[model samples]
Target chain A: MASGIAFGVVYLVYQPFNAWITEVFKGPALPVTIVTFIFCIVVSLLTPPSTHTEEERVALVMAERNQEKTASVR
Target chain B: MVSGQYAVLFVIGFFVYIGLMILIAYMTSKKGTTQGEDYLMGGRNVGLLLLICTAAATAVGTGTSVGATANGFRDGWLGAVYPLANAIGLVTVAFCFSHVRKHKFRTLCEELQFYYDGSPYMRKFMSVVIFIVSIVWVGSAINGGANYLAYLIGMDMIPAKIITVLAFGVYVFVGGYMAVVWTDAIQAVLLFGGFVTIAILAIPAAGGFDNIRAAYEAAGNPGAMTAFGVGSKGVLGVLAVALASYYGAMAGPTAHMRVYTAKSPQTARKAILIAAAVVGCFSILPAIVGMSGFTIASNTGAESVLANPDFTFAYMATTVFPPAIGLVCLIAGLSAIMSSADSDAIAGVTTFLTDVYALIFKKPVEDKDIPKYSRIILVIMLVGAFGMTIFANDIMSYINNVIGSFTPGMAVALLVGRFWKRTT
Candidate 1:
């Protein structure tokens, strides 16, 4: 949600856009959400998984697959 | 048609309708839900119909109904964009987060921590943000309900705000989340019926669909007749509104709570899908209702309506519909606001009691004390939020600001943390 918060801060900070700018991009939120979303991923790739996160991912994915398999079988 | 002439009827009708909701809440609940699960999640056994109704009702809330009506007044068919966004959000939730129910998370924070592999930093920081977002959302709901009430009854905003908060507050305190879902079901019926009834009656009242187009073009807002809003809010503007809505819906504390409240993963997923379809249909009503209000306003040159289009929903109801029909219609408008408010309030209180309060004081709340603490926190938070509403300029702005300010950080965090592994 940092994307939203950052947009809010920018929106509250000033009306930076002319009418054309706002009409075109909706005041930086799209770009912000896109940027932060990507930024988080890049930063994440640079770091290690949280302790046991891989294990958590394994269980989570397993449960999801099992549920799908159960549904299909039934 | 004058508001003062119908004040008594409106008051009586509103209270009676509130009474019906309370009755529904009482009947649906069992011995007032003393258990934490029952109080917080309606025993997490919410059936499909109840889940769909509550989810739709919550999704509609102030922004989708009152705010959209106001939007429709100015922008025409573009008002449908708001509910359209909600539909998208619900569908996304159903698919992306369908498996969350299996984990049985009490708060989004727990899910966050799990996503981060038991990391406590994000959870501790985001809890306070989640609680504040709930208050801001409830605050906006109060503001939304009060806006229409003030115009409909010619009452001061302070009194209107108090009535709006208390109307939902009492029942929620008594019956907890069960009451919220039950009341929401009743409200979903009224909210749809009222908007549709007004839309049906209003088209003819304003002379017809052709007249609506003619009047809008005559007012120099040719964009008002088009779905994409050609004027100031063009295609991109509409998309901006949708993106903001999607973000809010994805991370809204109350929406998260409801997802967890569902009986199962399949049920939650199905309920949200149904809610999306229902809201998709409901979007058209506001487009018609708001356009009708604009048609009437342009014809009559009602300065009150022109100056404050937010009041157009109630203004149209009070002036256009017959007295009895109008009274129920206005209550439904208030219900649209309260459905969201009460759930968010309960969700906030439960989160605070279970997450924040426990985190602060270093112990889980006693099982016996959960009910008492929940009520106390609800009162405190509502009062604080009520105070905030008195100063808000408009429901749309209040909702957008409050939601936009806090939700993106958590929403992005959840997406990144849950789906990605290397986040330590």
Candidate 2:
């Protein structure tokens, strides 16, 4: 949801921002760079940090492997 | 027509390149056993550099080189929009989904299964969709490569397509993902070096930037000098294509699969950022080269190549440089096509072996059998792609339609599932 919203905002702002930057700065890089930076910042802030960690992921895999082993034994 | 000497150089250069790739595959395969996981996912132990190379190589396809330059020739600076969008999308992926590297997911279907709370139906559906997308992607790459070959060497398109598909397929069949990544790294370098050299050379040949600008203005297309290319699609249309292309690629099966091979989440993030920077810089080259082509065409009354923008890159390479050097540029463009084709071929086969075959049989493939099965599947996919190429008349339109229809929804799903807890 947050990602979708951030994408929406970037999409909305990019055109006008692009036009303004082209008009003022007379270059394509500055406008794209600025807008991309803004978009990344927005997305980073809005999206939640991942809850799954390496240790937990490893444990999950181990547990599944063990279950598979036991089932095969049966 | 390519001079006989140039054509011989092209043939030798192409064959030698393909032979080197196969040799790499042979050498790499000898280092380890070809278990399915090892073959398909690089043993899930890819370091940062290889990750960056494979990701960038896969992302910057023939479209970025040939098609992008073509668009630049036709639309001026507006041609940069697609690559710019792709760079932003890569950055977004790095920020939003880098953590995916921590998980042991293999295919987008597996990711979708997790996102949808272990729903088998979602996995099945996505597997089919991604598989189809992979096929189309492979076909498009082959089509692009063959077109370049036809234009450069004056070979018939059908034989060129066959040779293109077969050349890449041999390496992947022999070495699998390892071959794909290692060759991708080489191709990425070739691709960037070739295009940048062309851009640099073409600028002076086209009579400098001022002449190119004057030529564009004189062409009398509205917004020719502007960034958005006459605003034909308006702001919304441009934004839509940009966003759609970027996010769709992010959500693509090949892109997602790269995350699984990263050694660490941080490595994946860094690799994606590197790829973004590379792509962002590369986005301008094609437009510049194309615009230069436009200028030359205008001055020399060579409007036929201008009429068909697809030929701009090849035409410029042949015209602006000496025969020997132009052949190098053509090979570099061919590298762009091969890099993407090999990656998609692997992705398609992986999806088939993991998603379709495993699901149908209700059993995971044994490690010992993975390489054999993967090789068989790779050949089948190549044959399918070759068949599809017969009908692929317009490469860009086919690619755009596929990306437009599939990528946005997948991107949304991937984002929502990764960040939101209640996605299911």
Index of the highest-lDDT prediction: 1
Those runs of model 2 whose alpha carbons end farther than 4 Å from true positions after fitting are A1-74, B228-233, B391-403
Worst 10 residues of 2 chain B by lDDT: B396-405
lDDT of 2 at A28: 32
**TM-score of chain A, predicted model 2, versus the true chain A, to 2 decimals:** 0.38
TM-score of 1: 0.90
lDDT of 1 by residue, B246-321 (tens): 7777767766777888999899999989998999898888878888999999899889888888887888888888
TM-score of each model, paired residue for residue: 0.90, 0.84
DockQ of 1: 0.26
What is the alpha-carbon lDDT for the whole of candidate 2?
0.75
Docking class of 1: acceptable
Error of 2 at B49 (Å): 1.5
The lDDT for every candidate, in the order shown, is 0.77, 0.75
**Model 1 steric clash pairs:** A1-B408, A1-B409, A1-B410, A1-B411, A1-B412, A2-B408, A2-B409, A4-B408
- Lowest summed lDDT over 10 consecutive residues: which window, candidate 1 chain A? A65-74
- In candidate 2, position B233 carries an lDDT of 36
On DockQ, the candidate that comes out on top is 1
